[model samples]
Target chain A: MKTLRLLYMAEVKLSVREMSSVIFGILLPVGLMGLMGMFADTQLELIRAFAAIATIGLVSTGIMSLPLSLSSYREKKVLKRYKVTPISPTHLLAAHVLHCFSLSTLSMVLVFLVAWLGFGLEIVGSLWLFLGGYVFVMIAIHSIGMLVASVSPREKTTGAISSALFFPMFLLSGATIPLTILPEFMQTLAQIFPLTHGITILTDIATINEFNTVSFLILFVLTGICLMISVKTFKWE
Target chain B: MGEVIRVSGLTKRFGQKIAVQDLHLSVRAGSIFGLLGSNGAGKSTTIDCMLGTERADAGEIRILGTDPRANRRSLFQHVGVQFQESAFQSGLKVREICEITHSLYENPIDWQKTVAEFELSDKLKTTISDLSGGERQKLCILLAMMGRPKVIFLDELTTGLDPVARRDIWQTLLRLKQTGVTLFLTSHYMDEVEKLCDEILVIKGGKELIRGTAADVVHRTDSENMDEAFVKLVEEGIR
Candidate 1:
């Protein structure tokens, strides 16, 4: 327990010091939401933009930042070094997950604050439902990130694979460009991505006082599968 | 003195290649033991197996009277290891790394004292990415010693240090020895082994080629120095 706490504190410090994590995880989403607020002419547009900004935090941290850090740790043999200590590899991995989750939560809170203060946007849904969906989305996305980190042989390869996954998910998941604007085939294809379900769940809860039960179930199932595979395949070296 | 490390018939294989084959060795308490081998000679593989970081195909290892694999938590509480290519997180400061490592053991040395002893006080706030090679090696030593371990493994301990820094590290090791800590070290520098090791084991092709006191091995091989004895033993196939 003490070791975990120490590791968590160290991880938090390291995560905060990383400039790219700060830029992508916090700055990009909050900046996008602030920009959207200035141009959104309708309450619905503002709400959708706010919801999409929230998913941007999730996807950016989950797909881009989290895997990159884990793979870098592997590449540098940081994980291997820890294996010789009394601290278990599981503790190190849990610390990183908790650190990234906390960063994601902070980013979402900033997006909410900026949208509510600057754009006069309000969530019309059950706040409890929104929070619940948000947690599930984070779990699903982070699990996918862990899976990617575990399978990639090196940090550079993880970066390449994560970027390949990130851009398409960012564009077609109704985060940047709405699903209504996307071609029919693209919209259908987006359904295969966890990010699409995450954004849809958040937007539904924030706008309609409810969320899609199917998306919630799908995301929960995906989280379980990804977490299992990642744990099974994880290598300290 | 009780044996701190005991290994018998240790074997490890990677797919088709044997990494360590039928290896056996022992180290008495409070002694300095040197392990030497050429590249790919299973020095690291043996260390990995002994440290419980990798599984052995067949062997029994009793480290401090406990199987490292079965009792890792207890084993690690008393053992410290410095790997040849280990690294801390690049963004962590020297002090932050010290603090985190300090928390891992039940009884750790004072972090400030360790930093001072290692001449790392100046690098306390420096991130790992900004550290010089010798500074990084010093940090590794500081971390390994922080646990106040009963047995410490140092792999390529002075690989990147200058002569002054290497001498300082040698003095530190000698001090640790005076405190009754068992040292298991590997180095390419034969003089380091001659100066520090009470027992020396030279391996080639995953098998022991020579084992004795450094001077005894030199005398047995009829060589003038450890380096010459090492080459003669390897060339003569462990006679």
Candidate 2:
């Protein structure tokens, strides 16, 4: 736990010091949240129609931000440096996932605040359940990010790959569109992704207390499988 | 006495090109060992194998009397490695790098004293990215020496440094020898091998051409200088 804290502090300081990433990772998320809030009244009907739009934070950090961070570290040999040291890969990987988790949580809070203050949105769900589902979604999507980073040829290519994977997940996960109105094939394809299950369950419990045991089980299985594969396939150098 | 490093019948092949072939060596504690080879002669490959960064095709390697294949993390705790390139986060300060490395080892050298010895006290807070080539090399040595390691591996240690820095590092290596640390170093600079190494292994075409003390190898070639001796041995092999 102490080692995890040390690694987290190191990664956070390094990330904060890098201005370009800071702009995208921190400022951009806040800006996008604000942009959504600015039109929340007209969009409130649309957003509240499918409350999963609130999970844009999870997708941004997990699918886009985290992969780029890991890929960049690989390119810079930070991961390789850790390989030569006494640090275990599991600890390092845990630190990375924890860092992404914290960042995504922060982004979610910002978006929630904007929605509440601007659009008079109300979160009617159990806070603990929302947090659990949020963390699971972060872990599952961050696992995909690690998989992409491991396969990317270079850090420069991470952005293109992550962006390519990000938009579809965000749109189809009910962040930008309502899954209820989509065709059955699209919804089924989206269900294979954790974002759909995560947002669906999180919004259901938060707004209506409509818990689906099947969706929760699907999330657990997907998270378990991806976490195993990411841990097995991740390469430092 | 523990064997610091051992390799037997180690081979590395890159597609059709054989980098190292049928290599066998044992370095004992408290001795300075050298892997002398010219460009692309597979010195780095052998070092990589011992470091457990790359696997040997057909041989066994034990670092510090433990199989590196099985106990990489356990052995790594007592080993310090300096690569040829400036292989560090350049944006990090020298002091920060030292502190971070110290955290990794069970017993680390005093950072202030280490920096003073390297004449790097003035550059403690300076970012590695802003350092000169010689300064960066000194920083690398400083980091490698910080933990008072049992064994140190240096690959092409003086490649891109000025003469003064190279001489400073050689003097430091001699000091480290007095403290009874095993040193396994690879270099194309024959002069460096002659000055610092207690024993040298000359490798060419992925095989050992000769292995002996500096004086013994020079005497065998009937050459006054180590450079001329190396050339004579290589030329003889060509014939």
Candidate 3:
């Protein structure tokens, strides 16, 4: 669609024009993974470790940082200008969502490449499963980001709320500490957040042959719910 | 002439504060209409309601003979707007903003003409972050003009600009009117309302205080200028 193209171009231009976000979102993950891989004891350990690192990068970029930037733009009244034009609200939202998702995806690929080439890691499953899990996580997290942006009154508030929401998910999702090490209660609690299911899917793709359909389905449902709430709650003013 | 916009019994409330109350007005096609009120006078609220950006609790709005509430997309093509506090991507240049806006319309105006007329040719490559207040205002006006809508809404359009910049924009607005573009602009400047508007709507505390031609308001009140007439009307209340 012509509208889609315009939205894509706008997103690309806005992101690429200022290289800082790209550095933070795309290159930062790869750099962190490379450093960790160097210190990693073995190829298997490095591959196992990458799930957490990538999750951190993706969550920060897609959930916290991108939403803060957008809400700040709204607080500055930048988004109000679009209201007058023929461009619809859906187009603007789609562009921002695509921008964050693509950058986060690129970061994922870069980190995986480093893990594969630099550390000689092996993925035991179909590449499609890895890609699918990656896409699912990105959409689900991006939807949460939109919900954050929709409710945050100001950019500063967006930053605060995003961090508060993300850090607990980051630590408890079996990404950093394996679920096997956690107590029974904590392990049960982890299932409430999408990151738990998402990391489970990602690790399954990397360490095993088949995808975790239960985890994948749960994540897909969560993504849909977040997206609907985001659309319903978004305020233009 | 056709009625371009009609509002009857429009009211908007945010929690306990009513932003607009029983607002009624009509803007004829191909004419300049001004909304005059001081700060917190509900000028922006009224404009937002008409644009369907703010949902009114009670009322009817017919823009181009269709309900703006239910037919925003169709009405959007016929209406252009610039809000009171507008911002842009600081990295965007004036030329790019114009180009992007031009794409939104089915039949857009010439970007070349827009740039030349707005005197933005020299700043084509200038990023918005580096632009001064007047330059940003110029860009905003240019963005509004690109679509050549049948009606344009400008809220506090000249609040920050210097006199020279304001005059330039006024001239450009007049030129646009020559092409049969109806304008709905809001400002606190009485002289601006008197000079540019064929009819003025004075609002106070979220309601219509007075509506008539500049000369009619002035002559009816025996005031020397529109400002005095406005002050008298607000103080005495609309009888």
Candidate 4:
């Protein structure tokens, strides 16, 4: 427990020092939310905007930052350095997950506060259910990110692969443009992405109090599969 | 002296190329052992196999009477390694690296003393990437010694240091050798091998060209010194 705590603190401190967390995870999402909420002439538009904007942190951290950081460590041989110690690779992996998850939460909070205080945004459903849904979304997406890191043939290739998947999801998963505003065929195409279902879950729970069991189950099963593969095949160097 | 490490009939191949083939060696306890080889001669691969970071295609290895691949957690507490190319996080401070390494061990020495005695106290707050090459090398050494292991594996231990720093490290290593700690190192510097290694093994093309004391190798090659002996072997062709 103590070792985990120390590793966690070190991971957090290093991430903060890099300034990528504040820039992409926090500032970019918060800035985007502020801009999108401004043109909300009606409550329905405002709700759709928040629904889309809430996931920026999860997508950015899970698909972009997390995999890249792990790949960088491998490229630099930091993971190799850690392998000789008594500290298990499991410890290093767990600390990374916890650190990225917490950063995602902080990013979500800042975005939420902007919606609530600056624009009087309100969540109509149970906050507990919303929280559970939010956590599930994080785990599912983070699992996919970890799986990419595990399966990538080379350290430098992780960036290309992850960025290719990230931008389309970023723009269409409802952040830059709400999924509802798009035409029917594009929304159907967007359904292929994991982020779309995550947005669907958050939107359903926040606005309509509907659980969207299909989307929830998709994310749950995905989290299980990705986590299993990641654990079985992850490499240190 | 009891043998601390043993490798026999070890072979490793990368696709069509055999990196190491049918190699064998043993390091007795409390002696400074050196592995000297040219580039691409599979020195790193052999070390990796011995450390269990890389699997060997054939043969057996035992460190302290246990297989490293199957029993890392229990065995690594008594082992430390300084990799030739491994690095620390660039954003991390020296103290944080020390703290994390100290936490990883089941029984760690007082790292504070290690830092002060090595003259690294003033660099505690400095970022790892900001340290000079020699300073970084010193930091790597400090981290390797944190666990007070029975045996240490050092790859290119003094690749980037001045004369004074290199001699200081040599003195330090010799003192540690007196305290019953086994040292295993790979180096390109013949002078370092002649001055420090109690037993030396020189290899070419991943096969043992010669193994004995520096004096024995000099006598066998009919050379005047360790440098001439090594060059003579290289000129004679390993194949």
DockQ for each of the predicted structures, in order?
0.76, 0.36, 0.47, 0.73
TM-scores for all predictions = 0.96, 0.85, 0.90, 0.95
Q: How well does each candidate reproduce the native contacts, as fnat?
A: 0.79, 0.33, 0.46, 0.75
> How many pairs of residues collide in model 4?
0
Clashing pairs in 3: none
DockQ pick, better of 2 and 3: 3
lDDT of 3 by residue, A34-71 (tens): 88788788655676667656665577667766687688
lDDT of 2 by residue, B117-211 (tens): 77889998888888887778778777777667889888888888778878888888888888988999987677888888888888887899988
Clashing pairs in 2: A125-A206
Q: Show the lowest summed lDDT stretch of 10 residues, model 3 chain B.
A: B86-95
Q: What is the interface RMSD of candidate 1, in Å?
A: 1.2
Better of 1 and 3 by lDDT: 1
Q: In model 2, which regions exceed 4 Å deviation?
A: A42-54, A75-77, A117-119, A157-159, A167-197, A212-221, B1-3, B13-17, B222-224, B228-239
Comparing 1 and 3 on TM-score, the stronger one: 1
lDDT of candidate 3 over B10-89, digit per residue (tens):
99998999988998999999999998877888988888889877889999998889877687766778788888776665
In angstroms, the error of model 4 at A45 is: 3.0
Q: What order do candidates take by DockQ, descending?
A: 1, 4, 3, 2
- The lDDT of model 3 is 0.78
lDDT of 1 by residue, B1-239 (tens): 99999999999999999989999999999999999988788999999999988999998999999998898887788999999875777788888888889999898998898788778889889987788777787788778988889999999989877888788788888998999999999998888999999998999989888899999999998889998888887777644
Point out the worst 10-residue segment of candidate 3 chain A by lDDT: A81-90
Error of 2 at B8 (Å): 2.8
lDDT (C-alpha) at residue B191 in model 2: 82
TM-score of chain A of each: 0.93, 0.78, 0.83, 0.94
Fraction of real interface contacts that model 2 preserves: 0.33
